[model samples]
Target: MTDALSDLARAHGVATAYTTDRGHRVDVTPDTLVAVLAACGVDAGTERAARAALEAHRSERAARLLPPCVLVRVPVGDGSGGRGASDRRAGRRGGPQDPGGTDTTPPLYLPEHTHAAVQLEHGGTVPLSPGLPPGHHTLHVRTPDGRQACAPLLAVPERLPAPARRTWGFLVQLYSVLSRRSWGMGDLGDLAELASWSGRELGAGFVQLGPLHAVEPGALPDPSPYRPSSRRFADPMHVRVEAVPEYAYLDASARPAVERLVERARQLNDSVLSGSSLIDREAVLDLKRRALRAVHDVPLSPGRAAAFAAYTEREGQGLTDHATWCALADVYGGAWRSWPAELRDPRSPAVARAREELAEAVDHHRWLAWITDEQLAAAQAAAVGAGMPVGLVHDLAVGVAPEGADAWALQRCLATGMSVGAPPDDFNPRGQDWGQPPWRPDALAAEGYRPFAELLRAGLRHAGALRVDHVMGLSRLWWVPEGRPPTEGTYVGYDRDAMLGVLALEAYRAGAGVIGEDLGTVEDGMREELAARGMLGTSVQRFEYLGGSTGRHGPLPPDQWRADCLATLTTHDLPTTAAWLSGEHVELRARLGLLTRPEAAEKAAAAAERDGWLAELARLGLLPDPGGEVAALHRFLRLTPARMLGVWLPDATGDRRPQNLPGTATVHPNWRLPVADARGRPVPLEELPRTALLRTLADVFADLEEESPHDPHDTDRAPDDTTENANANETEERHGRPGSC
Candidate 1:
């Protein structure tokens, strides 16, 4: 690539070259660069276009007195110690003589004697300075050269709020954890019951669930929560119809149909628990929708009506847009790209007319959103009421489906002809196209990151802590051009400071903690930065080996683990603890033809790893003469100084199947299995408390908590504090689950 083109790419936050996980520097091709630039609304098809774009970019920067947005760091003590990378990006750090504040690192770019004031998010205006309070504020500035500008100003906390008490929680795939009360699959009622039982009866701290975002409305909508129709709204399919307030008020005409639907749902639930079928989301949705519509026909009480109105008003246009999309999808299909050109644009007059024509349908969808939100709030309330310090940790997926509600509604802010994905790496030599549209960085800045902030707000609304999937996307993402292989994608950078600042601000507002899934190929300093901002990182116990060879290396000792993370034995996409110990994962992979190596070799490697873990457990005295490997693993996790520990809910029942298998699509029944026991018998939520293994795992955590309380002082200890030499060959695993096909 020519220097001008390279410079233009850099200016636009497009990578010209990047280092692979294997340490090889692969230069992005000129064609790839141009295609990516085009996605970002820049024309770089030729040298002339590249030179012109670069000059224009430079000129724009030169003319701007204030950036599109400004980030203000609110310190720890008196708001002076919360400096972050945003400060450094703004301008050079000033010394003691600086006029802003004691910890004001980033000074303004305004000329000397410039006047500035900030309008806080809540209310009131104040002069822009170090004393500016934490909020999503607006900055009004007048430079000495007679230039004036305004920008979004974020004064965010340096770090997120830490968990009040070091505690252990259950990490669950909600759909898989069906209860007797569920309508075939797990619902919010099931979630509430689990949280209440675990928190009060089992002494658990929280329940971390997989993404519960709304899925597309269709017969065979993608089952993966990681790929959702709208992140802003909770999935209505997860709503417990029996729990709706209006259910009891159904008139005589509707009561019989509702009762029949309930009976049919009961049968469906029985089928799943009997292993006669997978969790049928489509059937469940159909049953619930009919029952919910019948309930919707019933007159709402005055109080309930007011509450629903307040919710719709608070949600504002986001909910309206989502409901409108659903209404349109019911007619034109889920993929808005195929919709009539006039109707595709959300803001067009045609949509306004359609929205009016389908007002009742829109209202029904809106009602669905409201009811889902109500259930989510109820679940969190139950957790907190049951004494969970960090009540519910909600998962936020990286991006929304390209053909879903969010993509249709926020078309202007998302890249039109690009998808978010991973570049070619060791684990995935072919790379992956996730088919989720990425946010346009330039558009995000131009729009003051309203969409991003809204997403965080929605996720954190009922969450005691929010777990961000692919958190590295906050800084950058691999952008694959339309119809191109993922291997041809290049990295596109986001304003890291602004992204983190907004997250911190929203999280702080909600009084919630943040956990970043910082696995896979993380950028240097990414973990440290997340830690600095009070965001926790994820650490899977099985992957935290000190070295490569199973016999020569040992599991990372408890004390060696990072204190600022949610340490667990495994995640949804990985093998369960029982499966890993028995080498079932290897066998399953071989059965599915997903193994690149011979089955024998893979099994041998898995066995070696299991034996190594057993040896470590025995050495640490965690393994008794007849102790269970699953309990021993929990005991090991308890020893880690990590602020929070996660017990995969399926592990409590010795489930061997993974909630998701990364590589295979239809060949493997991913995201459709119910939580089953060792013999593959589906275990209901009601049976969970009586299970000997579940109680045993609970005892493991309870015993440790009673024996030794966590020291808040040790919460932020670095993972390398122990004496073990962690010089393991860093072959990064594929970090996240693939987007649902």
Candidate 2:
């Protein structure tokens, strides 16, 4: 059984991107699991410690394939145990400081280390060395961490970097990027321009954009950018067609309708770009799709058609199936399942009947996709034109809707009896069901993992970098069977070997770097798995802190964290720096009664944590005051030293609205809100330069430090030439640029 478990670990490690370390194979069978741990230099003492650590996670009833293997570290010697608080110091001399009270700087602990490296599958070591050690250490080890992905902490040497070696990066949301050329929302054009400017001016190495995936055009079509239709495709709304070379040759008379559609899109974009009004993403997408369709019908030369056909083949049945669904839905109805039973099974003769009936619509949908694909290629091309490295980092969502095309098309591959969700955690105690279907792990391997691989290829092909959201999902997904609440969800493990291997294979070929968003409650050793596969991890400054200490919520100390990571200030899912600074998130959630019981205490504590973090920044002299506004957030972020820094698009513009409100769908505007300029005005792309928000954001982007590991401006002799940079232009006008917002 031990040998089997080690083999299984070797064969089934979940993180497709990070399954192996030092090229050392992982054994899933129990004995090999023990062996793998030993290979990591874990001795009998460490193994005994790991077993002791694993005991607490034991289940009265074991879960097949998933036996609470994760071991939350408990401190010994010092009599401390359980995941140690990430805070730097156990006690501080001062209390929280008030932003309004004074410009007093508070004490901050920016602990770091350069010792204790992470051993990878490729035989490379990830120097996790920090300058200062937390009261206790937290290390993630594979196999050794029980089924839960948790492992016991093993301390190594602590070698801190000199203070002068530290660096900082800004964070922003892409949609919030306002530029003279952008439509209402920020597009790739805006992103390119922003990256170029930021990379060059602020000396910023990388610029992070919001998830830029293809989305449906409709009122409130799930504004949470994370829940996308197709993670592989770029959102057509981000396409800046005018920037396309073909756009210049459209016959004058033939271009009128195209131009007219652009005008309407621009008009709709205005609702988002220049006003306090919420962005109607669906309206914007609808207009852009229509416009793109016109462009597609522009009689593509044989070469273009041939290229599109090749793309169609490359996108495979999934893309084609989705296109077919869109076409059928336009005429038959919104729900494909609700469509005539004959049309339900894509491979069925009934589908054939439906296809005949909706041939034109299907063709139209396919054409739209082709144009979207072409434009995406162009956008990547633009990045290359701008001399950006790691151009167009595409974000891959966690899962797909059960009723959506993926579920409908690959029904056999998905678990019909289960949905994916989270277990009870600090933030969401009730636990949460994401309402998306989970893949049948068994089915995935049987099918040669084609579905997952194909999806990855689509996304990676056009991107210089790709981010796997909730990367831990590749290891173990919380599977809540149908009719079960999220809390009842059990863990359904994947074939981690295949998943991570395929991901590495794809990434290796694409010449793209991988970043895993390993946030929230993660299983132990998950980070180790990712690090082993040469995948970068995500580290957020705001969430970094100590446990007992104030603001000790998440991964603390940039220096203490792993080096193969993207250091960021904020995320689209979280409040922007500006919003966080103003405490608007808590207030909004409170208004909605979203806080847990004893709401007042939670609010006060949360406020205290926020203030405590600010106080620390002041102490370090990173901020002028213990509590200032958004600027303090920026300065505070600048204190962390991570190699790859990601600046959110919205943060640059000081956009207050979060791209996503995790618990709220309809209650909160969510993804519907487009980025506006300062003073709450929507600043369209064309009008971006005119807006104070855009200027400030651009100024911020320009002022960031340059030459991050993932630099956009670096033009070394050898590289992929697809990434674009600093190119805001007319194509961006489709969203609502230069007008009305």
Each candidate's lDDT (Cα)? Answer: 0.82, 0.53
Instruction: Kindly provide the TM-score of model 2 when superposed on the true structure, using C-alpha atoms.
Output: 0.68
Model 2 is weakest, by summed lDDT over 10 consecutive residues, at 723-732
The Cα RMSD in angstroms, rounded to one decimal, for candidate 2 relative to the true structure is 16.5
TM-score of 1: 0.94
Off by over 4 Å in 1: 76-80, 84-107, 547-552, 703-731
Task: Name the top TM-score candidate.
Answer: 1
For each candidate, give its TM-score against the true structure. 0.94, 0.68
Candidate 1 positional error at 453, Å: 0.9
Task: Please give the lDDT score at residue 616 for candidate 1.
Answer: 88
Clashes within 3 Å, all models in order: 5, 113
Candidate 1 residue lDDT tens string, 1-741? 899999888777788888877779889999999998898889999999999999998898777777666766776452226553232233221111111111212455566677777788888987766666677778777766788888877777766655556888899989999998888999999999999999999899889998999888786556778889888898899999989999988899889999999999999999999999999889998999889989888887899999999999999999999999999999988889999999999999999999999999999999999999999999999999998888899999999989999999999999989998887776788877888999888788777778999999999999999999988888888889989999899888877767887888898889898999977767666777787777888888767877521223677777777777898999888899999988899989898888888898998988988988888888999877244889988888888778889999889998998888886657888889999999899999999989988988888788434433344345474435332233234337545555633
512: Cα error in model 2, Å: 0.7
503-601: candidate 2 lDDT, tens digit per residue: 765665576767788765454456655665567777666645544112234334333434557766777667777777677878877888877766677
